[model samples]
Structure formats: structure tokens, C-alpha cells
Target: MTAAKHIELMSVEDYLAREELALEKSEYLGGYVYAMAGARNAHNLVATRLLVELSKRLEGGPCSAWNSDTKVRVRTNGYTYLYYPDASVVCDPNPGADVYHDRPVLVAEVLSPSTRRSDEGEKRIIYSQLPSMKLYLLLEQDECRVTVYRRTAEAFDLEAYSGLDSVIPLPELGIELPLEPLYRGIENA
Candidate 1:
């Protein structure tokens, strides 16, 4: 008979402390930690562009744009999930800790082939659960395509934008992102 392998889990506090001193970033889900994969050039470019645009438009405002290094903490009935989104905007920053933000007004993920499933499926569902989250963006790195989820009274409304001329209107943040600049310098996008 084959023996079953044992898996150990780390507490949230331990994970946070270790993550601070770790060389590479990792995401925490419940009691398990998963290593994060490095993003490609196109993914990096798209994330940077979105952050830059958001920062420019939100200068001196209450909200601030954060890079992927910052983690978003999601608490459910039975579990806690910490994810590092490509870019996130927080209007009401959490004063308790600098490591993670619990309330984010907007979160964006640059889609890659490897992360497409999680980004669109699990991440999307969990991110929408945040009461403060008003918008979610899924940006395509290899193409000028964006999937926007805007929060409505009852539920989230889905919108799609494609082509360089298309503009993503984020009334929640009072900013509009032009697709041309977002996909700029991305070869074959």
C-alpha cells in the first residue's frame, strides 16, 4: 500500500511574517500558501500602463493606486484569501496594516494564458464579494480587449471593450482609460 503524504499548513500570522522576509511573492489561501509565477513582458507592460494612468488621474485624491506587490485580503465565512492583483485602487486604506488592503475600490488583473482561468473564475468571484469593490478589470496583454465588471444595485454588470479606439469609463474613480495607451508598446497586441 502507498502511504499518503502529509501536508502542513501555516497560520495567517506566520505566513505574513514569512512573506515579509521571503525573496519572492506568494499568495495565501486559508492556511495554504501558493508561490506566484513571474509575469511576461507584455503582462508587465499592461499592468504598468494601467497603474500609471490610474495614478495620474487620481493624483492628490483620496484613492491611491497600488502595484502587484501589494496584497488584497479577502475574508470569507470559513477562510481567508490573500491575492496580489496586477493593480488595485483603494479609496479607504486599511489603517491596521500596511501589508494588505481589505477594502479596494477597484482591482485589475492583466490576463495571461496561465492565469486566465483563475483570474476570470475564482478571483473574479471572490473580488466581487468585497463591498467596497466597485469595478473589476480583466485586461488582455496580447490583444486590445478588456472585460469590465461594474457593480450595480442588484449585481455586477459585465461590459466588454475592444479595439484601440475604445475607452474604459470608470465613473467610480472618475477616470477614463484609453485602450490605445494601455496596449501601447505591446508587440502584436
Candidate 2:
């Protein structure tokens, strides 16, 4: 009989410290870290488009848009997790000394086949747990569909939009993001 081997998990502090020297980005969940996959062309396009539009709208305001490189820390069920959304908007003036932001009013994720399940499932649930999150956008890479989850007093409300004329309204930020830019350079398959 073979003896079972025990694997030790990395602490959050060590994980964060190691991440600074890592060549590629990875996410921290509980005591384990998971490597993040690279984004596809369509995914990058959508993220960039949204980021640009949001940046334009948030210029000189209390809020600002952050690209995927900016880490977002989320706390849920007594566990701490760090993630990098496709794009995020943070309205808080004080972001703390850590490299990650704890309060993001908006978080966007460009859907990919490999990550679709986790994005729509675990990520969704964890993101909703954020007290400051007002809107969550799930952009489709294969199509022009954009799903918006607006937070309400009770729960997050769902809204879906498709087509170039449709616009996503973020009442919290007072910005209306048009959908045309998101699918601008996506080649039809």
C-alpha cells in the first residue's frame, strides 16, 4: 500500500507576495491559488470597449474604471478571495494600501466557453456578496448579448440587451453604456 501525501496550501499573504513576482496573473481562493487563462480576441475586445466607455464617463468623477490587471478582493462566508474582473468601476475614495480594491460598484466579465460555467456560477454568487457592487455585466463573446444584474434592496435584478441600439444603464454611476462598441471588431464565425 502506498502512503498518502499531504499537500500544504499557501497562505493569503504569501500568495499575494508571490503574485507580485509571478509572470502571469492568478486568482486566490481560500488557501489555494488558481492560474487564470488568457483571454480570446473577442473577450479582450469586449473588455476594452467597456473599459474605454466607462473611463470616459467616469473622468474627473469620484469613480474610476480599472482594467483586468487590477485585483479585486471579495469576502464571503468567512473566506477571502481575490479576482480580476474583465473591468471594474470603483467609487470609493480610499482604496486602502493593499494592491487590490475591496469596493467595486461595477464588475464586468467577458464570457468564454472555458470560463462560462464558473463565471455564471461561482463568480456570480461571490460577486453578488459584495456590499458595494451595484451592477454586474456579463458580456457574450460569440454574440452581441449583454446581461446586466442590477442590485436592488432585496437582490440583484436581471436585464438582458442585444443589438447595436441597446444600451446598458448604470443608475448608480449615472452612465449609459452603448452596446455597439462591444461588438465592433468581433468577426462572425
Which candidate comes out best when scored by lDDT?
1
Model 2 quality (TM-score):
0.93
Q: In model 2, state the lDDT of residue 164.
A: 78
User: Model 1 scores what on Cα lDDT?
Assistant: 0.92
Query: Lowest summed-lDDT stretch of 10 residues in model 1?
Result: 180-189
- How many residue pairs in model 2 have overlapping backbones? 0
Candidate 2 lDDT, 29-99, residue by residue in tens:
87779999998887888888889999998898889999998888998898999998999999983445678
RMSD of 1: 1.5
In model 1, which runs have C-alpha deviations exceeding 4 angstroms? 1-6
Candidate 1 residue-wise lDDT, 1-189, digit = tens: 999999898889999999999999999988999998899999999999999999998998899999998999999877899999999999999885679999999999999989999999999999988999999999999999999999999999999999888999998988888899898767665
lDDT of predicted model 2: 0.88
